[model samples]
Target: MSRIQANLLLTLIALIWGSAFVAQSHGMQELGPMMFTGLRFLVGALVVLPLAWREWNYLAGRQLALNRDDGLKILGLGMLLTLGAAMQQIGIKYTTVTNAGFLTALYVPLVPVLGWLLLRQLPHWSVWPGALACLVGAFLLSGAQSLEIGLGDSWVIASALPWGLHVLLIGRVADRMAAPFLVACGQFFVCGLLALIWGLLFEPFSGAGIQAAATPILYTGILSVGVAFTAQVVAQRYAHAADAAIVLSSETLFAALFGYWLMGDRLAPAGLAGCALILGSLLVVQLLPLLQPAKTSSEVLPIK
Candidate 1:
């Protein structure tokens, strides 16, 4: 659709994703990180499978061959997503909600840089300034007190790398397949399968944790994964990868605001400044293309 519609879509996605952050954090109250993740993906996969199946009709006959490049690409993308989600969910347990929210949002800046190095294609000129602003916002938002990076901090760092890669993977594959199917079925299956293996092998899957997580886990499984992700599939289809990254990054703003409003967390001085930078960043990024007279949808219940 039009750019106006895209902005609206991204905004709604941001709001949903922001609210779900609280859900994800709460869901872990009873579930082990891995068990929670596995169960969520399993439920999400079941939710989206029918939609993905509808898209399969487009790939008839030999197009569906296992040896096809699309098959391999989709598989590889799924693996990276699995890695990112595992690190993020577990890392969230150790980090403050504020840090967890902004740290993960760093992937917005990471996308353009990774795309440049790997694809030999630089992002729009807006990316550099946006990255710097985001970095400053990150520093302030982090409240480092002297740049200390703890275990949880390190996990957040690790999570950014894969998430950036995940965006890159989606960008490459976006033009080649059914966006919804790739998002709903292909990538998710990979995530589900790998998480299943990880949970079974390394995690405690006792009934206590699983049952404890029943309500929150159920919230995460259905709304966060199932509904939010469907929005992402549709929305991302309408924008370029880098632009999509910025729009998705709006989650940081929403998350911080939501935390304060819902959890009684007050905004510190740094929080106030960080929030401004985020708002400024959003305004600049959104207006850049239009000011230059150039450039740039779904049930997409986007997650991040």
Candidate 2:
């Protein structure tokens, strides 16, 4: 995919993710987090079921369809994603929303380092400066006058490592698998099943616990993870990681905007400053085209 296409994908990913938070917050009002996650992902997977036949056909020519190893690889990816997601969900529950937002943003910077370690690809030097900017932004966005790591902060911060790892894994495997099929299908199949078993073994009464969260549940399952994630996989196929990260990072901005518009949350002065810094850093990374300038906002915003 061209750079233009990549930027557009990231933008769409950010928009979807940002909007989903509204659904998640609303859903959690009535449902338990784990159960909510499970059902929502299952909804997304069901959406992708129609594409499974296409995947089966595609894979049959290049690889085995009903093989143990193939199943294991996808399952492994699912397990890792679930672990990261569970950690993140728990982190958000404990920490202030401010901390969760910026902390999770660390995954963008963390990706380059993880890439270096796993793929033997040296990252750009500019990444370090961008990472530092992101760190300060997190500190500021957390709205803390004094630096004190609460238990919640620790969990959220720690979870970002796994989230970063998940991104790297996706980046590596996006080319190998049927991107939409794997993303949408596996959300329900892999994470859904795992969450279900976890709920049964540990907290079986989840359905009864969160029966009233239908709106959010349906929104997340059908729209956010199901549609947005499939789009992300398709977009990633076209965009570079750095460009993609820049676009998706807009989730923070979207969340803040939506929070203010929909939920009456205010963006403090410092918070806006942090947001600007993060946005600037993200934009700074896109100067790689040199002779050919990347397109403007049209490339960054996808109406679809």
Best by lDDT: 1
Worst 10 residues of 2 by lDDT: 295-304
Q: Which stretches of candidate 2 lie over 4 Å from their true place?
A: 1-13, 61-66, 95-99, 150-154, 178-180, 204-209, 233-246, 285-304
lDDT (Cα, tens digit) per residue for candidate 1, span 221-284:
6666776777666666676545564677678777777776765556579867875775566556
Candidate 1 CA-lDDT value: 0.69
The lDDT per prediction is 0.69, 0.64
lDDT of 2 by residue, 23-43 (tens): 666665655556666777777
- Model 1 residue runs over 4 Å out of place are 1-10, 61-67, 232-249, 282-291, 297-303
Best by TM-score: 1
